[model samples]
Target: MSDGIIGLIGIVALLTLLLLRLPVAFAMFIVGFLGLWIVDGWNVAAGLLSSETFTLASKPELVVIPLFILMGNVASASGMSRQLYDAAYSLIGHVRGGLASATIIGCGGFAALSGSSVASALTMGKVSLKEMERFKYDDRLSTGSVAAGGTLGILIPPSTGFVIYAILTEQSIGRLFMAGILPGILLLMVFVLTVLILCLIQPSFGPPGPKTSFSEKRRALVGALPILVLVLVTIGGIYRGFFSPEEAAGVGAGLAILYGLFTRSLSFSALKEAITDSVVTTATVMLILIAAHLLNPFFALTHITETVGNFLAYLDLSVLGTLLFILAVYLVLGCFLEGFAMLVLTLPIFFPVVLELGIDPIWFGVLVVLTLEMGLISPPVGINVFIVKSVAPRVPLGQIFRGVIPFWLAMVATLGVLIAFPQISLFLPNTMFN
Candidate 1:
């Protein structure tokens, strides 16, 4: 059989394995290893397995993953995330739907620290859900806002999603980080706007929270000051070329630990737990990357990327049409597959087509990450919705799904805006790097 046909069979088998509840890393590893063995030989496959594992494990760039994860874990353990939420609540909690808006702002800030949607959702859900319940906010709006806002984690700077995308496409992590900034802010605004409109239409959905005195606002802001400063230092240092992404991550992680210790908010046991969580999360990401590297070579041997490129060419679609087509596929795949798995599985096939079409990789990376965010709240496999459900066990799963729909539509609108004006995604990176 042709290599292309063999590759196609391998992909089908991989999907079957995933559908059967096999882990993403193992499924990719199995498919990639067997594809290599079939097309090349056992010796070549074994050689690659060892080399790829070592190469990814020892890479300096991957160090950012663990460091940023640790920063997030430490922040969560230390009540930094709670401080951020309180600061946001004090400033805006008095307005109609302000509480939900504050939750989104908190999620965005925590996303900067954590670069994890699950972490953002879980931490914020724990912090805000009960408070919202106390204030009699509708569970749908409360749960939905947390689920949707948490997705900001992947689009903001220090994002693990961007790091993986950068590695896969051989793009600059700093540039991708810069590219995400404006788009992340734009999405945050869109979500807040959605909440405002929802509350306007149905005032009972999110009641106006109590107004805080100026002193209270100041105190809450003071509590959150350390995290704000840390975010500025790490991200600003990268923008000014004073620190590489890796350096920034290490600094952020170190600062997070110091703040936790100084405030006595992070006990020894909590610190240890944070480290363990970071290690486990980092290991999962690394295994996926190594598996992707192995799978990439198999796809290359079969010339699947080239074949896919040709098929796109045969369609005679304009650049925008092709781009939209690819994004549409992502939206569909997102319903069934986890975001990272979908990313690794498809980028090798689709990214070359993007490069061939001369689309800017940084802009495309932002767009792809945004689409992944939508998937996190999309139905059936809405992972963030599930995360929110876990935190608010009393809320029905269906209610959480319903709550996310408006925000999900808001995401669709935000996606359109980003696509219409690619400059939003490119402006920061272009201005900084150029």
Candidate 2:
């Protein structure tokens, strides 16, 4: 049998396993092992497993993964999220759709500190949804706002998604991290605009939030300064070569913990919970990384990426057309997988095709992450939306899904702009690093 045929069957089997509700990492591991055995026999598969697991798992740069995850968990467990939301609300909560806008802004800030989208959603959702609901905000709008907002975690600095992309593509993690800043801010603006427009068109979707005194707003700004400083320092350090990515994570984690402790907010129990949560989340991410590394060799043996490249070329697509095709695939697959998993799974296959087509990897990464953001908010498996629903049980899941449409449109519009003007993503990385 042909390697191509074996590859096709392997893909089908993998999907079938996914349909059967197998865990993603396990599914990849099992199919990859069989595919390797079929194409290269058991002896090669054994050696491949042993060496790939060690190399991928023990790498020093990988230390950043746990550190960043630890920082996020600490913030979540210690209730820093409320400080973020309340501060955002103090300024905007009086305006129409202010809470919704604040939700997006808060999510963006949280995303920077934490790379996990679900963590962002759960943390922010638990804090913001009740307040929005109390203001009689439309269920759809309130829930959707939080759901769409949580996806910012994947696009913002220190994002695990960008880290994995850099590792896989051999791009500089720093450049990829730098590249995300402009696009992340652009996307945040899109969500805020979407909320404004939605409230303008349908006033019932958002009642006026309680007005804060000017003095209160001033206080709120002061409260949020620490978050702003943290973002600037971490991103600045990375871009200015003040530290490597892992070193930056270590610094961020240490400072965040100290900040928590200095305020007398981080108690012993809180600290223990934060460390346990971070350790578990970090282990989960690392395991998935190990699985992806395991699968890559088998994928190569069967020439899957090469075949994908050949197939894309055979269509004689213009650059834009090829990009659209790849985007469509990601959007569909994203429904079943989180952005991080989708990125890890498909980059090996599609990135080769993209590189061949002369597309910028940095630009493509932003576009891909934006598209997956939509999937993260849409039903029947929008994880962030589910998170919002869980936190605010009175808000119907369907309503939350409906509310996300405006932001979803905003996300799509931002994507189109990026697609048309690659410089939106590339110009920053080139100017700063080059």
Candidate 3:
């Protein structure tokens, strides 16, 4: 049989394994190893396994993963996430639907620090859910805002989603980071507008909060200053070329540790837990990256990317139609697979097709990440929905899903805007680097 046919069979088997509840890393590894053995030999497969693991581990860019994760874990353990929520609450809580709006804003801020959708959702959920409940906000508004907002984690600068995309596609990490900024802010605004429109139409869904006195607002802002500084320094330093992403992550993690110590918010045990959590998260990401490397070689051997590129060329669709078709596939996969899994699985096939169509890689990266954000809130496998559900267990799972529907539509709208104006995603990267 042709190696391309073997590659097709391998993909089918990988999907079956995923459906059978096998871990994504393991499934990819198994398929990749076997495919390599078939295309080359057992020796080549064995050699690749060791070399790829070590290469991925030793890469400097990979260090950013653990450091940024530690920064987030320390931030969470130090109660900074709470402070962020409080600051947002103090400023905007009095407005109609303001609390939900604050939750979305807070999630955006925490997302900058955490670079993780799950962490952003979980941290914001724990910090804001009770406050919204106390104010008698509708379960849909309260939970939906948190679930939708958490997706900002992947779109914002310093995002793990962008990092992985950069790694997988051999693109510039800094450029990708820059690319996400404007689009991230745009999506955040869309989410806030969605909340405003929802509350404007039905005031009962979100009642106005009590206005904070100036002094109280001042205090809240002051309390959150440290985290704000950390985010600015890390992201800004990268923008100014003062630090690489890995350096920024190290500095951010160190600052997080110092902030926790100064405030005494993190006890010895809590610090340990933060480190452990960072290690665990980093290990999982590393394994996925390594597995992707294994699978990449298999695709190269089988010319799967070239095959798909040819098929796409044969279709002769306009650029917009072709991009939409790729996005539709992502949307469909979002219903069944986790965001990261879908990313690793599809990028190999679609990325080449994108290049053949003369699309910008960084622009496409932002677009793909946005689609992954939608998946995080999409039904059936909406990871953020479940994360919010865990924090607000009394709310029905269906209710949280119902809540995210408006935000999901907002995501679709944001995707449309980005597509129509690629400049939104490309502007920062082009201007800043140029």
The candidate maximizing TM-score is: 1
Cα lDDT, model 3, residue 200? 91
lDDT of 2 by residue, 1-434 (tens): 99888988988887788768787788888988888888999998888888888988878888888888888887776667777887888978888899999998898889988987888888888888888878888888888888889989888877888878887777777778888888889999989988988999998888888788989888888888877787777888887778888888998898889988998878889899888888887777777778788788877878899888888889988999999999999888877766666877788899888887888888888788778777898666688888888898876677888888788788888889888888888877787633
lDDT of 1 by residue, 1-434 (tens): 99999998988998899888799999999999999999999998999999998987887888999999999999999999999999999999999889999999999999999999999999999999999999999999999999999999999989999999998889999999999999999999999999999999999999999999999999999999999899999998899888999999999999999999998999999999999999999989998999999998999998888888999899999999999999999999889889999999999999989988899999999999999999999979899999999999999999999999999999999999999999999888887734
Query: What's the lDDT for candidate 1?
Result: 0.94
Task: Give candidate 1's TM-score.
Answer: 0.99
Candidate 2: residue 108 Cα off by (Å): 0.7
Per-model lDDT: 0.94, 0.83, 0.92
Give the TM-score (vs. native) of candidate 3: 0.98
**Worst 10 contiguous positions by lDDT, candidate 2:** 425-434
Q: Which of 1 and 2 is ahead in lDDT?
A: 1
TM-score for every candidate vs. truth?
0.99, 0.97, 0.98
Better of 2 and 3 by TM-score: 3
- Highest lDDT: which candidate? 1
In model 3, residue pairs whose N, Cα or C atoms come closer than 3 Å (at least 3 residues apart or on different chains), thus clashing, are: none
lDDT of 2: 0.83
Shift in Å, residue 160, candidate 2: 1.1
Worst 10 residues of 3 by lDDT: 425-434
Evaluate model 3: give its lDDT. Answer: 0.92
